[model samples]
Target: MDFTLSGQQRDRCASVLARTQTAFPAGPGDHQPTASASAYTRAEWSRLADLGLLGASVPTAEGGGGLGALDTALVFESAGRGCADTGILFAAAAHLFSCGMPILDFAPPDTRKRLLPRMCSGELIAGNAMTEPESGSDVARLTVTARRVADGFLLSGTKSFVSNGPVADVFVTYATTDPQAGHLGVTAFVVERGAPGLAVGQPLDKMGLLSCPAAAVTFDDCFVPDEQVLGAPGQGGAIFQHSMRWERSCLFAVYLGVQQRLLDRCVEHVRQRRQSGKRLAEFQSVSNRVVDMKLRLESGRLLLYRACDALDRDDPDASLWVSLSKLAVSEAAVASSLDAMQLFGGRGCLREEGIEAAVRDALPTTVFSGTSEIQRQLIARSIGL
Candidate 1:
């Protein structure tokens, strides 16, 4: 019930936010032409690694800060507020929550021992590969196969729309070992990069989050040694769902930070810009819209932090909270971004102003980490409706 951040958490967020603002280099020229590919330059990526952000949620024993769920959310919220590139922010979230946590919790002990330290140190980048061309939201029906081999499993299939795909050094991905067994047939693996048969496709052009490159990954009889298997052979479904709980709860915190930043920008613009000797903020129409944005943000923050607490406590309604939190924050981001753009007028439409870019990044929130429709369905089921 007490969602106020601890003093230590506040300090951590401040430190992270200050550093994030200065990390990204300015665009090539004063007049930025268009959204570039969401590629992570080595320098920016290294700077992130140096900040210890890559390992914020990992345990200190594994070279991380060992922050709890609330602390981790706070840190990411800070990053979202100042980071110039949504792709980088998105990749960081995917790396920390979607890819890293699953491996830390479910991978074989030897695999964890081998990967966690490097991943935490930023020596390696990790990606979660679950979406397939044929099965976007249906995990049970994935066609990717992990066939038994002499000493391990031979993985063969394509994982599409893989965030961090172009640059990942390891993947916490899924495949089915027994198609006839339905969900019970699913198996997860820690597939390392450069495994002979594994190949990354060209980066896909996206509407937003241009700084983070996404690509398809094809596994052609890629051998995953026995030690690389995560959990049991038939438990990948549960493992994937467990990771999604973390992603849906905390990942949207990035959007929260972004929305807050946009709100501040709009407030500043309206107060200073005058119409017929009256400031825009003085107009009831503009002020009312701003208040609405604020209300959505405050309410959504409550839901998100509560969901993080629920996950920490392993509450019975943890799943429901996660779904609600994801839905609230994501929808709020898309709506708030639009308000920010409209308030800024023509400048908002310009690619160089960065307001429209936020809208583009916000658009995908409802689709990934489960759609808004899926969240509502889950909530309906929880109350026996």
Candidate 2:
């Protein structure tokens, strides 16, 4: 399969990269001392929205660009190379995965008409509320409950580790309407911010991705109108599953750009730095490490491109390919980041230099959107092994 990007896609990627470099330069103060540090740059977010890059993957019918997953991934990869703020990319990926695709695929007409336009215009921010305190990877075991009410449904539950929870204008939340039905009992609802009895909890301190705010959300008899329900009752599991597949597959394209940056830095460093009267690249050990980094970087890109192709084709094996791509890209990114840090020696550890920050930021790739172990299990199931 020819993985070369089309000429138009290449131009789009170049444009985004140029804009991001000029508008969002990495700074010494970019490193956060606290885990709960607000990492999003409102101006940058607005700029991306204005460019219509925020809605690149949404359908054109909804006022979006209607770009495919591959195009979106390329844009994200470019952004990652240019910006140190991971929060912006995370927010975009979350919005596309949770709100853009699912709503386009399954939402009722009125709901779509009301939400998609604002989302396309970048006037609204959306999040996914899935992980409960008791249930992280186990979607079937979620304890949050929603009971049928006269007008809509009374939702009462707590969702933990919610991305963009504090600032989200809307949330795609999952709850159980009938615990006895297990996965079949779950349903999805669009919960607007500031709705009655809804509260955003304190933001959690995380080890990495400091810019992407994560918090717990509590719904205490919060009423969601029947019209707000996504898909239908008992379809939450399927929706969640599909959303996660997309998230895991395409979200790391941004990191691909980061890997490219690291590779360039490594190349420059080895060429310019001398060790024991010889350039760093002359040393067999240094050359081998650089080669390893290149291998990981190239292979990761291939996996992502393959996954994107599968998605575009609407292939039946798309889910398996996506899981594999997620596993490959995330783990490879972590390895590449670590290798880059090691190649830089003590300079990489210095906070102001940004290598340490890259390492820290890459740490979360393996844990979110379903952990690495979960990906392995899914892949295993696909092969019936």
Candidate 3:
């Protein structure tokens, strides 16, 4: 399979990087300020909208770029590289790929028509609330419940670790309509922010990606109209699975960009920073670590690109490939960040150099999307374990 990007794709990537670079926030000194109070500030939000990033994957008929999976990977990877502020990048991915894509794909006509246009215009922010307090990777076990009413459904329970939660205008949420049916019971819904009983908690002060605010969302007898149900009552598990395919396959590309950025900065640092009357790059240990970072970077790119290509091609192994790619890229991100920290030594630990931030950002790779442990189990099962 060929992995080279097309001319148009390269141009698209370059263009995206340019806009993202201009708008992303830069931390002054040691303290990193989030681009805004929430995951997105209006200024950067408009810039992304103006750049056509908000709708990169929407169909042209929907007033979007109408790009495919590979195009999404390309655009976002560039966005990740252009902005060292991975928080904004993460917020962008959660909105477009994780939350928006599913709504566009599975939501009813009225629901999509009401939300997607504004979402693409950056007038609306969406969050996917999948992980519950009790169940993270074990998505089938979430306890949130949805009961049908004359008007629609009354949803009750809490969703935890919701990325983009604090600032979301709408949520693509899941709740079980029938606890006995297991995965089949979970139903997906498009719950607007002002719905009667939906309340968003204060943004969690996370260890990394401070700009991308996360929070717990509570639905205490919240009413969702019938039109807002995505797909059907029993199909939420399927919808969530579909969204995960997009999230794991595309969102992790941000890490690919981060790893590349880390490598670039490290190379520049070692070449310029001196030790023992010689450049840091002259030392075998430092040089070898750089080599290892390169190795992980290329491997990650290959895995992600291959998974993307497989999805575009509709290959039978697409799911397996996506899981593998997510695993590889996420793990590589953590590994490469460590190497960057090691190479920078004292400065790596210092918040001012931005090296420590990368490490903190990369640390979450193992936990989100799918944990490294979950990925391994899924990969094994996919290959006939």
Candidate 4:
């Protein structure tokens, strides 16, 4: 019931924000820069690992911080506040919530002992491969298939828009084992990058979050041992849903941080910048827009925390709150970014100001982690409409 952070939690949040700001300082020249070689550098990944952020949600036994869902959201929010490059944060969230959590929860102990530590240590990276060309939001339409083999399975399919795919050491993907069984027939597997017949396509040219590399992954009879199978057969649906709930509830906190940062910048700008010999803050229209931004930021944070709390308590209605939080935070991010851009006048349109980049980054928030439309549909369905 209490939303206030404990002193220890406050210290963790401050430490993470300070470290992230130090590591990824924002500058005028730093706007919209593309990753030339790798999606993210090993050194950067190591820094996050050093901060214990990469493993914040992981159990201590698995070489992680063992933080719960609410604490994990705090970590992400702080990171988002400090890190100018939301791409890396986005990539890390995908790794933890989408790929790593499912494996941590559903994988066999042997598999966990083998991979989780490395993943937590930043020695290895993981990617989630669920979306396909024909299947984005709809899991039942997936075309990927996995055939049983002697000691393992043969997977044949292509997964599109896979975040961190280009550099991932392992992948948690889903494929149909019994097409007739529909969603129940789908199975999940943890496939290594070195698995035979696994091919990663060139990174997709993206509109924003350029530092987070996404690619299409093709599995041509890829071999996965029985030990790599996540849970039992026909369990992929549940596993995917479990990971997605974590993602939808916790990962969206990053946007909350981003919006906070944007709000801070806009507030400072309005106070300092003058128009017609008056501070921008003195203008009713300008001040009202800033007020709206503040309102959205605070409101979104409430929904986000509520969802995260529900997740921590294992509430049955957690999905509803998660969807509400996701939809609110995402749309708020985009709206606040636009308000920031407009308030900045011509400077916002310029790349050097970083405002335009924020818009581009915010644009996709509604699309990923389940689209805003999908979230609305889920919310309505939950309400018995």
How do the predictions measure up, each by TM-score?
Answer: 0.96, 0.95, 0.96, 0.98
For candidate 4, give the lDDT: 0.90
lDDT of 2 by residue, 79-135 (tens): 887777766677778887766778777788899889987887778878889999899
Task: Compute the lDDT for candidate 2.
Answer: 0.83
Q: Is candidate 2 or candidate 3 better by TM-score?
A: 3
The TM-score between candidate 2 and the true structure equals 0.95
Q: Which numbered prediction scores highest in TM-score against the true structure?
A: 4
Residue-wise C-alpha lDDT for candidate 3, range 156-273, written one tens digit per residue: 9999888889888989999989989999988999999999999999889888988788999999999999999999889998888888888897889988888888899899999999
In model 3, where do residues sit more than 4 Å from their true spots? 25-31, 34-39
Task: Show model 4 residue runs off by greater than 4 Å.
Answer: 29-32, 35-38
Q: Cα deviation of 262 in candidate 1 (Å)?
A: 0.4
Q: Is candidate 3 or candidate 4 better by TM-score?
A: 4
Write one digit per residue (lDDT tens) for candidate 1, span 1-385: 4656778888888998888877754352112224554377767777777766788878998778797777778888888887756668788889988888998898888889889988887788888899999998789999899999988999999999888899999998999999999989999998889898999999888887777778999999999999999999999999999999989987888888988888888899999999889999999999999998999998888989988888888898999989999999999999998998899898898777788888888999999999999899999998898
